[model samples]
Target: MSRQTSQKIAFALLTAAAVVVVVPIVLVIIYITIQGIGAINWEFLTAMPRNGMREGGILPAIVGTVVLTFGTAIVSIPLAIGAAIYLAEYARDTWLTRLIRLAIINLAGIPSVVYGLFGLGFFVLFLHLGTSLIAGSLTLGLMTLPIVISTAEEAIISVPQSFRVVSISLGGTRWQTIRHQVLPQALPGILTGIILGLERAAGETAPILFTVAAFYLPRLPRSPFDQSMALPYHLYVISTQVPGMSTEVQYGTALVLLALVLSMNVVAAILRSRFRRKRRW
Candidate 1:
């Protein structure tokens, strides 16, 4: 076959694959919105659940999800950024660094259910956190660390070598060069990774299941030590565990969860775009 024909065939195959991936996502969103839109109103948004999740709103679940996401960010971002900086800037191309990178890659591929079990054993049992928001947040932080570190390292490395050299030659310390010159340029990519990590942490069910989720908590948690009602766990409960659960309620829960994740992504996208537009080098 001619090169031109092969190129056309490749383009067609790629287009078909994109459609296959995207069509299902669009259809699922449409179906969920149609089923759940009725259940989303002032009362549904504000009020607490009643009659064992057959009535009332998902207020506690929403609050719990937000708190959990915040906690995970607090636990994850600084450590991940520090690790990324060390890997990208300070670490030499040695066996130790390579080993560390390999470990991070392996960590990223571990199943979510295994993270749940690890949380159960270490956070809950060993630390005596005992199925609370803090434990769950820690678990999620660990799960997301590899993503943040890898993205941030790549972002930092992408900054031009001349920028660092100029900064250092102009009497700036190594730390100063990284903080002022390297970090700013890398900020957009770092934010992208953080957004992706938070999205995953927010929507996860298994990791939180063993660490923080309460099956039917109607009241909002007052402290990190308290077990909270999260959206993913609540969806799992009502959709399967609760007998005769209202279909509207289940669909509404799913819609709200999707909305929460998508909203975070949208905000991150806007921020990243603004940063890119304003970026000086």
Candidate 2:
């Protein structure tokens, strides 16, 4: 085959592969919307769940999910970014950096159930937090640490080297150059990673199942140490644990959680767009 023809054939196969992957996702969204759209209601959202899932909403779970997400973000983002900054902007790309990167990747590869076990031992037993929101948040933060570090570092490294070189040529200090020029440009990507990390933390179940499991927390949490029902747990209870569960409520919880994750993703996309626009300017 001619080179151009070969290239065209490869592109065609890649496009087909993309479509194959995307088709299932599109179908899932459609199926979820159809199953859960009618269940989206103010009462369902605000009221306590009752009637074996036919009358209540997911208020406590929703609140817990949000708290866990935000709390995880608060705890993990700064530490991840600081680590990323040190690795990308300061440290030599030597054995030490390689070891750290490897360790981060390995952490991400560790099973969620193992994380749950660790959380149970440390946060629940050692820390004496019991099944509390703070315990869950700390576990979730640990869960997302690798994601935040790897992604934040990629974002930092993605900032054009030309920008750094120019700053250096202009006699800007390394720290000042990064602070004033490189970081702003990289901010959107970093934010995207942060949001994704939070989302991952929010959807987590295993680690949270051990450290933050709450049975029907009718009232919302007043503090981080308070125990609560998280969204993933709510879904599991509705879909799997609860007796005489209505399909509608189960599907509804799934849809709402899906929407929550998609909202985070959409916001990240908007931020990415604005960043690209600024780059053009």
Candidate 3:
């Protein structure tokens, strides 16, 4: 084949690959919307479940997922940011630092169910937190940390080295440079990481199952110490455990969960675009 023809063929293949990746996602959203749209209404969203979970709304599960996600952010963001700052700005290329990075990578690869077991044993039993909101939040936070730290460290490191040098030459202290120059510049990426981490936490079922998920609780949690129902676990229960469960309810729950995650992604994209527009570099 001529060189020009080969190039055209390669371009066509790349476009085909892109279509292959996107088609399934588009199909899934359309399928879920068709199957579940009838079940989505004000009453279904705002009221509590009734009739052995076959009727009424999933308000508690929705609230629980949101609350747990917020709590996970509280537990993870500070620690993740601190660790990322250390890794990016202060830590040297030493065996300890390498080991820490390796540990983070391994932690990210570990199965979510293992985190659930750890939360059950450590946070719930050993720490005496019980199978409550805090235990689940802690589990989800641990699960989320590796992603947040990796992205945040990358973000911090991506700031031009010259910027740091200029700040230092201006007589600014290391902490001041990081707090003002580095962090401000890196905030968009850090926020993206946080949103992605929290989005994953909000959707996971295994981590919350042993720590905080309520099997049939229809009421909203009153405090961080209380057990609550999350959408993932609820979906799992209704889809598998509940006999005679409505198909519409299952699809509706899935739709809501998908929408929640998509919403986070949309927000992340908007923030990233806005930040890029304002960026001087």
Candidate 4:
């Protein structure tokens, strides 16, 4: 075939692949919106669930998800960034480094349910955290660490070596050079990973199911030690476990969860764009 004809065929195939990926996503959003929009109102968002979650809203679940996600971020981001920096900048290629990378890769592939089991064992029972916000947050932090570390390592490694060389030539210490020059350039990519991790943590049912999720708690958690309702768990319970549950409520909960994740992604996209625009090199 002529090169132009081959190029046209490739373009057509690519467009078909894009449509195949996007159509399902669009259909899901449309279906959820149609099913859930009627149930979403001011009261549904702000009020506590009543009557075995058949009435009222999911305020506690929403609050719990937010708190849990924030806690996960707090616990995960610094550790991930530190590990990434060590791996990318300090750790020489050796057996130990290779082992660590292999471990991270393995962690990333582990099932979410397995993380839940590990959290139950280590954080809940062994540590005596007792299935609370703190235990759940720590579990999710661990679950997300691999993602953050891998993304951050790549981001840091992508920074041009000349920047580090210049900083070192000017008498800057290794830490100073990384803190002043490298980190700023890599922040956007690190944030991208963090955003993705947080989004996953927010929507995850399994990890929190064993660690923090309450079946019917309507009141807000007063402390990190307290058990609380989470959106994913709540949706799961109402949709499957609860008898005679309203379909509207189920769809509404799903819609809310979808919206929450999408909003986080939008914010991350905006930040990434702004940082990209600010890049000087």
Candidate 5:
């Protein structure tokens, strides 16, 4: 075959693969939106569930999911960024560091249900946090840490080595150099990772299932130590556990969860674009 023909064939194959990957996601979103749009009125969004979750709104679940997502971000972002900085910039090529990296990789590979079990055992039982928002947030945070750390570390490492060298040569301390030069450039990627991690944490059912999800709570949680309903678990219960749940309600809950994750992604994209524009190298 001619080189030109081979290149065209390869390009066409790649395009087809891309379309295959994207089409389903687009279809799913469209289907959910269509199914759920009828159920997304003000009363449905603002009121509490009634009639065994077949009527009314999902305010408590919405609030709980938002609060848990925020809590997860609070718990994970600082720790993940610090660990990433250490691993990417300060840590030497030692066995301990290697082991840490390996652990992170393994953590990322572990199933979500395992994290839920750990949360139930460690956070809920051992730490005496009980089945509450804090416990679930911690569980989700732990589950999300590996992703954020891996992405942030790569972002930090991607900063040009010459930038660090120049900062040091200009009489800047190590910490100062990183604070002023390295972090600014890496901020976009770090923010992207943090948002992505939070997005997953927001959507996950398993981590919250054991730690925090209330089977039928209708009120907003008063504190982090209180059991609350989250969208994922709420949707799961209505879809499977309830004998005669409304299809509209189930799809509406899924739509809300999807919207929440997509909103985080949009924010990440915006932040990444703005910061990349500001970056000098």
Candidate 6:
């Protein structure tokens, strides 16, 4: 075949591959929105949970999701940024750093249920925290830590060394250069990582199951120490708690969960794009 023909074939193949990924995602989103459209009413958002009722809202679950996700972000973002800074600025790509990186990757790869077991033993009994939001938040924080650290480290390290040199040439110290120049440049990427981390924390079920997700909590969370029901557990119950029972509610819960996570992902995408377009550094 001619070179032009081969190039066209390769281009077409790549395009096909992109479409293969996009099509299913599109269908899933469409399906969720359609199935969940009925579940998007004010009552659905405002009412309380009923264990065996035909109609009830997800107020506690919604609140629990927001609180846990935000709490996880608050807990993880600082530590992740600190670790990222240490990795990008101070830590060498030596055996220790490499080992740490591998451990983080392994943690990320471990099944969610395993994390649940760890949380149940350590956070619940060992610490005597019970199934509190604090425990769940911390569990999720650890789960998202690797993602945040790796992404932030990549962002920080991607800064041009010449910028650091320029700051140093101006008689700035290493800390000053990093704090003022490198960090500003890396903030967008770091924030993007944080957004993704929180997104992960929101959709997680297994860890929260053992940590904070209460079975029949009837009220909204009053504090981080409050035990509560959540979106993921609700979805699980709706799906498996009964067969041919409350399918609409099941689909509705699924839709709400899907929408919550999706909105987060869209926000992350927008933040990343916006930072890319208007980033000063």
Best by TM-score: 5
TM-score of every candidate relative to the true structure: 0.95, 0.94, 0.97, 0.97, 0.98, 0.94
Could you give candidate 6's per-residue lDDT for residues 23-99 as a string of tens digits? 99899888877777876788888898664534678788888998899889888999999998998899977999998
lDDT of 1: 0.94
Candidate ranking (lDDT, best to worst):
3, 4, 1, 5, 2, 6
Give the alpha carbon lDDT tens digit for every residue of 4-110 in model 1. 99999999999999999999989999999999998899888878899998899899999999999999999999999999999999999999999999999999999
Could you tell me which residue pairs clash in candidate 2? 49-56
- In angstroms, the error of model 3 at 220 is 0.9
Clashing pairs for predicted structure model 1, backbone only: none
Candidate 3 lDDT over 46-133, as tens digits, reads 9999998999999999999999999999999999999999999999999999999999999999999999999999999999999899
How does residue 161 of candidate 6 score in lDDT? 97
> How does each model score on lDDT?
0.94, 0.86, 0.96, 0.95, 0.94, 0.86
CA shift of 129, model 3, Å: 0.5
In candidate 6, stretches whose alpha carbon ends up further than 4 angstroms from where it belongs are: 51-53
Score candidate 3 by TM-score against the native: 0.97
Which 10 residues in a row give candidate 1 its minimum summed lDDT? 272-281
The alpha-carbon lDDT assigned to residue 251 of candidate 6 equals: 75
Residue-wise lDDT of candidate 4 within 25-119, one digit each (tens)? 89999999999999999999999999999999999999999999999999999999999999999999999999999999999999999999999
Per-residue lDDT of 1-281 in model 2, one digit per residue for the tens? 99999999999999999999999989999999899888989988887776655577888888889888888888898899999899889999799889998999999999998989998899988989888888888888988999988888898999889999999999999999999888898888788889888888888888889888686777788887889988898888777777777787788888988898889899889888988888752
lDDT of 4: 0.95
Summing lDDT over every window of 10 consecutive residues in candidate 2, give the lowest-scoring window.
47-56
RMSD score of candidate 6 (Å): 1.7
- Residue 31 in model 2: shift from native, Å? 0.7
